[model samples]
Target: MNIDNRIKFRHLLCFLEIARQGSLARAAEALAISQPAVSKTLKELEEILATRLFERSKQGVTPTSAGLAFLRYAGPSVQALRAGVHSLRSGEHEAGVARLGVLSTVESSLLPDVVRRLHDQHAALVVSVVTGPSAYLLGQLRVGALDLVVGRMTDSPQIEGLTFEHLYSESMILVVRPGHALLQVDLRDRSRLGDYPVVLPLAGTTIRRYADSLFVQCGIALPQQRLETLSVALSRRYVQSSDAVWIAPQDAVRQDLARGELVELDIGLREPGGSVGICSNPTTPPSLATQWCCEALRTAAADYRAALYP
Candidate 1:
């Protein structure tokens, strides 16, 4: 279809917003425009595609079959274009900028310190931090959507053309509200852990997988409870008031532990240690900003390791 070039990026963006939000009114509100403006833009899109993209029903707009198929390709294209433009705009004269993808786990653990150090060292460089699941983030790095990712190497992730450098090691622990029975050294036994209701991250997440492996390795079944979430705040709240033991990275709950808000299990459970690291595509040369960030992350990991373990 030789669609006119006048039907441009904005039109596709508007259509995506409507598709994502499931209503023209919501999409218009998100775009900070009038509802009629959204309606007019969708009309332009329908004309370009030569078909109805949305089924207008009482339930609001739902993408038609053709629209669904088109978006599967278009969405990624737009994201890639945006990433490319951001890269170009952020490039430097001698040492270009790099986008760093960080899984939330690592971001919560190490990024704050690393970013500060990076800024202090490379005053003129730009580093954009992106977040997502490890699998998704690695795919983005492979396709130049990102230059590097700070992620946990808790499991051997299966991805091609990527290199992992071990930045530091961390151990998992059972965290709960201060003065919880589990923290009582006398009650902090293996059998006690098996008896308590535990709040755990979803099984598929790296931390949960590691905890499961630890339980299996010890030949013990974890006490049944809720497979909750990865939110530190929510878990912290649960631990503060309930008899829920949450398995989490030591770094994630360190401050709470120090403040007497939460306590780590002294159960002497077999430690399940994992490496936190930096990942990048081996095929591409990393920009200076990326290299700097990697070094800064390593430094931060070292400092954290010393504070937590030493």
Candidate 2:
């Protein structure tokens, strides 16, 4: 394939911004260039491709099929170029940076271990971590804004178009502070859990489905009084100080359980649990730092996962 020598980074940059903003004017403002310059650049790109890339309208510009096709390649190229430029700018000795998105489940245990291992090996490397729901983070991953997404997001609908590698399986655990009254009795008693305030994952999350299922499996009704949240820190803190029982991802409360700060209610789960792993865009060639982090995640998870399931 003979690539056009006239095609430049500027052309792709302009096209991406125009497609993203849906207007030449907005793209111009973003790029700090005049609208005419934006139009001219788009024209040059279209000419180079010998195809009409976008259709102009009173509302805005919409990408033609060719434009969308160009966009898929251009987006990753720009992101990789930007990341490479960033690594070079950081310093010759620096290990570089990897952007990672973490869903809530692994944020507490597995993620920290991965980071610690990575930094210990390459102190100069910066690992930027973004925390959010699976859908949002996976969307960023598919767009190449994120290098890798960690945690249990295997069940997310947004996981389409990405690859997930399972490191281990995790399940929800019902926990409460030590010496709680409920701790003395049979946890299977549906009425016993309802007496104290309950802490749960926010409704609609993958973890919440497991939490809800636990109750149904045990024939327990949803507690009338419950604190709905996504914050592991908040839920852990709240559960420790009060009689509130927290339904948490096992990893989230692992340390607490080990240190005797929290105790799990022995309600055995029939199912293995949610899959915790790494999600990445197989199309994107990983940077050195990302490669290091991925290696670290796999190495660390081997030991971590062994202890978890065994």
Candidate 3:
């Protein structure tokens, strides 16, 4: 079938916002219009498509089967058009934008390197980064909210429709302050870890599973005094000030280890890491800035792998 010339950009905008916000009133607020206008615009869109795009209720709205099918194309269409408009309006100076979703997995080291390399190569590229969990980041990526997500989210169910490229594997290590008592003990003797306070990733995060498993591998239980958090900076600071043991992704504390500020303890695991990489929605065509970002990511990954392994 041919396109419906009757469907204007306003219809697409309204539909996308309603789906994103899940309520006509919220969509109206987002678009700076009245709720009635949002309803009228949505009704017009449903009429143009000759199908019910959303199932409405007091609880809010959810995309119908037809709406979901339409969204696959509509989301990317709007994102691409926006990027094109940005590039055109900025003349030849701007390289458009690359919106990124980041997890704690790369926030400390790898992400910084990629951004530096991206700006060094494409000075005028507009880059935005959002940091969060795998599930949230992947959800945003599946929509048009993010161009790509970079981290150890390969195992997340949300990674289903997106594409992931393995950069390298990063291991989890036990870390302590420079003069912590654990440093004096052998790996076998260190199994009595329950004696001290511990810092852990918050439950439900991808890395927390690894942190828990490290305890299982050592036949230890988390101490009664345990601090759980998503912030790497918080975990690092807390561990540095006290005797609390920390389960940290190697990359998160790589510089500290190198600088002798923190020490890594061997838990005797043969393999200690998970897949670290980049994930992007295959449906969307990447803009110039996103392409440059991907290229920079790949280059950074190559260097990261060599540095981590060798």
Candidate 4:
């Protein structure tokens, strides 16, 4: 099939946004256009390609097989075009840009410090950070949406195509607000933990597995009154204001522990914890900006490890 020049850039833009937002209205709002206009543009693009792109229903829209295939190419092409435009506008091609995916655990201190150092060294470089769960970040890294991901190394089959560089190790810690009633309870009496509300990562996360294992090792059942989340903000707020005990990564609450806002409970399990590292698709060569960002992260991780000893 010959290409149709009748399909404009706006058609691709509209199609990609619909795929991303999963609804015409949301995509219209993002593009600052009317819903009917978006619909028309999508119809035009579909006519040009002679294939349906999305399946519409009450739950919004989902890409069909054809849409998904197109998306794999469209997303990266759009991003590259935007990056080129940005470089031209800013006249900073040498500095370039690094798209990074970060996990919630590293947001405490490591990511911020690494970003600061990257900026200090490369003043014109643009660093974009996306923070989310490890699995989600890894998917984005593989799809070219992100240059690299910094977080716990996942052991799932999804990791087969990626390469991981060890940055540091972090373990789950049971934390509570200062002077919580659990502090007075005997450490060996694991049943006491059930009496209080518990905040834990949602099931299937790397940290949640460690947390659940800790309870099993103590021969205690998980608490019935439970709140599952991966958001550090929600977990911290709930744990501080209430008697809820939060099981989280030590690095996530490192500042809270240092400032006396939260205390770590001694569960007596010497679990080695999970490996925190940089994951990247092995097939894709790193850009200059990405290379710099990786180096900066390694330096920051080394500093963090050194501080653990000294």
Q: What does each candidate score in C-alpha RMSD?
A: 6.8, 4.6, 2.9, 3.9
By the lDDT metric, which is better: model 1 or model 2? 2
Candidate 4 wrong stretches, greater than 4 Å: 1-7, 43-52, 90-99, 130-148, 153-166, 202-206, 216-221, 270-273, 279-287, 305-310
Question: Where does candidate 4 have its weakest 10-residue lDDT segment?
Answer: 153-162
Against the true structure, candidate 1 reaches a TM-score of 0.66
lDDT of residue 202 for candidate 4: 81
Superposed model 1: Cα runs more than 4 Å off: 1-97, 217-219, 308-310
Measured against the true structure, the TM-scores of the candidates, in listed sequence, are: 0.66, 0.78, 0.86, 0.77
Better of 2 and 3 by lDDT: 3
Ranking by TM-score: 3, 2, 4, 1
Instruction: Rank all candidate structures by their lDDT, best first, as comma-separated numbers.
Output: 3, 2, 4, 1
Q: Considering summed lDDT, which 10 consecutive residues are worst modelled in model 3? A: 87-96
Which residue pairs come into collision in candidate 4? none
Q: Tens digits of per-residue lDDT for model 4 on 136-161?
A: 67666655678888888566444655
Best by TM-score: 3
Score each candidate by Cα lDDT: 0.73, 0.83, 0.84, 0.83
Tell me model 3's lDDT, rounded to 2 decimals.
0.84
Q: What is the clash tally of candidate 4? A: 0
By lDDT, the better pick of 3 and 4 is: 3
Model 4 gets an lDDT of 0.83
lDDT of 2: 0.83
